[model samples]
Target: MSVLKPKIMMLIGCLMTSSAMATEVEPYNKANAQQLKQSIYERTATATSAIERYQLAKSEAWLSYADHEYSEGGFTSAGKEAYIQANQLLEPSNVNLVTQIISPSQVMRRDLWWQIEYLKQRGALDVEPQALANAEVMLVWAAAEYCELGWRHAREHFISAERELQKVIYALPEEKPFLNWSETETPELSALNGKGCHGVNPDLWPLKPKTPVEPEVIDADVANVVVENVVHFAVDRAVLNTEGKRVLEQIANILAEYPDMNITLKGYTDIRASVAYNIALSQRRIDSVRDYLLEKGVNSSRITAEAKGKLEPQDDQKIEMAHAKSRRVVVYFNDAETNSITVQPQWRDLQIER
Candidate 1:
């Protein structure tokens, strides 16, 4: 049997959340495009060196792309972000473009923005404008997605931003700034340089490196495969604990990676209270999990939830400590019923948090 790609044949079509039907950008398209065009011409008229002319051309290209994305639906933020890149790359002589024209209070993507800015001040743009341009666009798009949509949509762009920026950083030498020519280059020690917001908190870092759930593909020809993960909650509590949150985050990551796989969150409660109350509690638990997944950018249309209180308990009744085992939300990743094998996550832990 030929091995198929990890495409979820049964899952919903992965759609861009913020890019399509971005009609709001229509009102500002002409004005924004004109602003960038004027800036480009201003630099073009003064561009005497071959390098300056090249940069100006790139700036114009980005402006054109911005116009195209703006005219298209569901790309309002992208158009704006591209527009920003066009202005930034121009870097007019003696013009404090970043410090004066752009707002220092930009809070999103600050660290990456700072490093990229530092590189621009050195010579990243002159050396490899396309690489630098891709990085800048990705960085701004990442932040814009986070601000407009959420982390689920933003994580992809953030990853791309880092990767593209690394290409530029690796290709270019660590040159000294024109003014601070004697200073050393240390990216790890760099600060936000009076930018309004403090860097992203480590505790709340979205998609920080973690052991990802590797689903095992049992067969190659069975397309009706379902991947499953479980999020265990505390006794009777609907709120998710730290461990539960981590489990759900991993689930969200899977959904992010597999757009075609629809998720079914089935909540189960231990055999303790009345079936009705337990059912309600189980629903609440699933609600908590579903809400977290939604906030992480999982489309609500792709999610289904069920409450199974005490009926389908995972059998924690034998041991005193096993009762908490039944209070869980089994996350099922369903694919289109075809002819592929099933995939399952390797996770089983009773999560208890006070």
Candidate 2:
């Protein structure tokens, strides 16, 4: 056999005799194992460009051995060490790949613990194991939930991001309160570094949406549909002063302008006397206006006379003037069959109760 062949054989023989290393190897002892270990070492060395490359190649061999141990149904402590060593060799340069692999799983999805563990594995953190792991975990969770928004509810992502960012900001060292990051780094991993977790886009979360204004509804069919305020009051007391007459004239003009418009004359009074007395007073007030309008040439059917006793008022006019606001007539134009009345009374001659 060649000189190198004998050395390879001797090294493999020694490796196989770990349980009894002091005992001299016989010629036939673990001949296959001796050949395999030597071949593994030789192939690793051949793949290398330099010592560093050799180290990486050795790491791969260690990984293969660990895989073999796992496949054999029992892993030794030494096998775990080999696996860890292999991972360490690959971690720093392969962060993005590792993140991609672990990010999608439910347990590791944007989870801080998993992120911290990953960073620790890559030797990015030098703190106590627990602290480093916990801190990274929070940042990972925040980035996953808030950055680009993965497969989770928006609200849940927002809440989780808030909590995680708060922890990361507060726990960071005073001198290095910000995380080290770069654009070319793992996009998902780098996205977690502090900025506005929720500030990706503002127009997306609009402060206020544009709204359309509705046009004011006016019934052209009603002749007395005056935009100006009109008020009415009890009989004898229902007499319109100069200002009241001006308002009344506006109503009349509105009716004249729209020939098809009809009017409903409603009268009301406060609870001054008995209900019956108030009811009569309201009817009288409405009649007085109807007579005046009739004399003014308005058709009797065009105006519907109705009375409301001591119920509706314009103002709580306890004195004569304020009472005048309460005791008044209201003209509803478009309410012919079905329409909601939205106009408020600004003028009236109705009784105001204390």
Name the 10 consecutive residues with the lowest summed lDDT in model 2: 202-211
TM-score, cand. 1: 0.34
Q: Write the residue-wise lDDT of candidate 2 on 83-109 in tens digits.
A: 444444332232121111112112223
Which lDDT tens digits does candidate 1 get at residues 261-338? 787888888778998999999999889888999999999999998888888755322343346567778887677631
- In Å, residue 104's CA in model 2 sits off its true spot by 88
- My TM-score estimates for the predictions, one after another, are 0.34, 0.31
lDDT values of the candidates?
0.56, 0.43
Which runs in model 1 stand beyond 4 Å of their true positions? 1-228, 337-349, 352-354
* Model 2 alpha-carbon drift over 4 Å, by segment: 1-226, 234-236, 313-322, 335-344, 348-354
lDDT of 2: 0.43
